[model samples]
Target: MNTIKTDVAIIGAGSAGLSAYRAAKAAGAAAILIEGGAHGTTCARVGCMPSKLLIAAAEAAHHAMHTDAFGVHIEGTVRIDGREVMARVKSERDRFVGFVVAGVDAMPGADKLSGYARFIDDNLLQVGEHTRVHAKSVVIATGSSPVMPAMYRALGNRAVVNDDVFSWDDLPKRVAVIGAGVIGLELGQALARLGVRVSVLGARGRVGPLTDPEVRNYAERVFSEAFRFEPRAQVQAAVRDVDEVRLRYVSGADELVEDTFDYVLVAAGRKPNVAGLALHNTSLELDANGLPVYDASTLQAGAHPVFIAGDANGVLPLLHEAADEGRGAGTNAARYPNVEPVERRAPISIAFTDPGIAMVGARHVDLTAESFVTGEVSFEDQGRSRVMLRNRGLMHVYVDRASRRFVGAEWIGPEAEHIAHLLAWALQMKLTIDEMLRMPFYHPVVEEGLRTALREAEVKLR
Candidate 1:
């Protein structure tokens, strides 16, 4: 067996691991990275990039289908070729994945091991069957895989997860998507807009954990135009046939829904990839979700000189958050056994559905009327939104009434991603409502919508 020694042994080469490896290198520490799967990050290969590619195609098809409302008549019928769409998506996806792989291949001062890694003991890591790595500190950044429920597993090849969805040369004419989370809703809508009969079976009362009742009402109303969504779904059983998949469920209204489809896409959620890590070897304890318990700020696992980053931590599963956590993990791992303070940014998240939804800082469920005042704006009648013909959402702003601090904002609206980013920066800076109002608001733009909400927030503060 080959034996190697390093300052840090980083597991997984996804977003978190790569960022941690680079940070370790910059900290003048020798780092070894091990990846058991493909080199491309989830965002590049399956999660975000490919979803956006499918959405882009869907948007184009949607525009053509809705030309009548815009006073533009189609000369002929607008058609979507599923095979060609998949070809384009795969072609672009490979380029992005290749770029990330090339960058990993060229990393300086780091040995890349292509194999599975497990904990032999604290400060000792084993790579596959041959090599053993001795490390002063370890960073566990193994990414997540889609949650395949036992019901779907029983279906074998008939059930498609996110990993298999993107690799298909053509999509099924009917796709029944289980779970109305980000993956289920986005892919469900994209396939719907592209002329696929898509049904979104959501476990929640509404889509994607929207807290505010008003916002939830508007989101369901707007998104309902794209596909069929069942918010309070209780799936009883699933059956697989030679040609199609069948689902037996009781709807929120207590109706028996027996649906059959060409394929079933299950996006219930994802769990941390820690089962193979042999975390039991170390003294690290796992949460109920099987994620290692670690400090959010320091990314340190108790006093074990082991750190957990990215999806493995099972905190926030966004790509950007994973990268930031990776960097923090590397910084702390390099300084392991010498603990120090590290600052973390406010929370932010977005879903890439029609009109979309974004949350910055705290959510409505996290605030109280006595502690924080609220402000709201309706995009049903906004200026730029009217021009774009995409005016279909509402916004809410949360402010600290006593301190007049901008605490958070949640909305389902146009350019939600951009607005959420702005609020995240403002919240991080601890910007007050008055201070935020002093900044420029570009007229006839989506940001003016923010000004309206800010003004409402200011009035409520008094």
Candidate 2:
């Protein structure tokens, strides 16, 4: 086997891995990027970009069908061509993937290895059958894979994942989506709007990433009205029969409902891709889940020269978070014994469902009731939301009682995506509720709803 020496060795060439490679090089360290799969990042390939494309199509279809409320009447029934919809989604998805691939192609050949890497020891890695790599430090940014539960495996080919949805030639007439989390809510709602019969079944009464009971309940009610949503669904069995899959579950009304769908989409969640990396071969301390115990700010695995980042670390799995982690991990790997702690941004996540769901900074579950006061606002009475005929939303902002500082927020509302960003910035700046209220609020806008919530928080803080 050929032996190559480098200052840093990064496993996986996805978003985190790519960022690690760039950061390592910029830190004046020779780094080798190893990959076992295709070049495209998950977001460009099957995640953020393509899913948004599908959601965009769904939004277009939904808007056309619902414009009657705005006094705009169509001459005839609106039609959705499944093949055409998928064609555009696939095409645009490929374009995004191409851009990512082009960047990877520009990297020097010697710095890129097309193979799976395993740790031979802390400072040594075996790259498939051809090469052995000796590096001073290593970064594991292997990303993650969609998890399919054991029951779903029985459905065979009829069971699919989010990655499989973007590759479909046409939309299925009926889809039973499991898990009411981000992936399920986004795709389930989109498919429902696009004229498909979608049933979203989830365990526990959670909706999207919401933990605040009021906000989660509001989201559950809103999405349930939009489609067939059964949170706390008692699933009995799921099996494949012929070309379709059958699901047996107990409904909320205590009735047994057995349904057959063209496909069963398992969006249960994702698992970090760390099992195959032979991490036990290294001297890194692992957690209960077998993930390397690393400092979030430093990304260093214990006191070793190994670092973990991105989806593999199982921290925030969002794209931006992954990039931040990767940069930190790579830089720490390059600097090794002289690694510096990285300043992490405030946590934020958004689900792109219409009447989007967002959580910024601290979550509702993370706060103590005694320490914080909750400020509430309902969009149904908001000026601009009523004007736009999109008056469905609820927001709860949390304020530190003693300090009156803006701590966090959870909401299900129109323009939550845009609204979440503003709240996130405030949390990062450690702005007090009064300070945020002092910021200009534009007249007759969705953001006015945010101001309304802030005002309520101010009142509660006193």
User: Which candidate number maximizes TM-score?
Assistant: 2
| C-alpha lDDT (0 to 100) for residue 198 of candidate 1 | 91
> Candidate 2 residues 26-111, lDDT tens each?
99999999998898999999999999999999999988988888899998999999999999999999999999999999999999
Please give each candidate's TM-score: 0.97, 0.99
Error of model 1, residue 386, in angstroms: 1.1
Clashing pairs in 2: none
Reference-based TM-score, model 2: 0.99
Among residues 3 or more apart in sequence or in different chains, the pairs in candidate 1 whose N, CA or C atoms overlap within 3 Å are none
> Candidate 2 — which residues are off by over 4 angstroms?
none
Per-residue accuracy of model 1 over 1-462 as CA lDDT, tens digit each:
999999999999999999999888888888899898989999999988988999999999998888787898999889899999999999999999999999987875348887899999988988989989999999999988889889888888889898898999996899889888878888898999999999899886767757888898888878777678887889999999887888899988899999899888998898889999887888787777666677776888877889989988777898988999899888788877875655578899998888888999998887885898788999889999988898888999999988999998888999999998899999999999999999998878988989999999898777
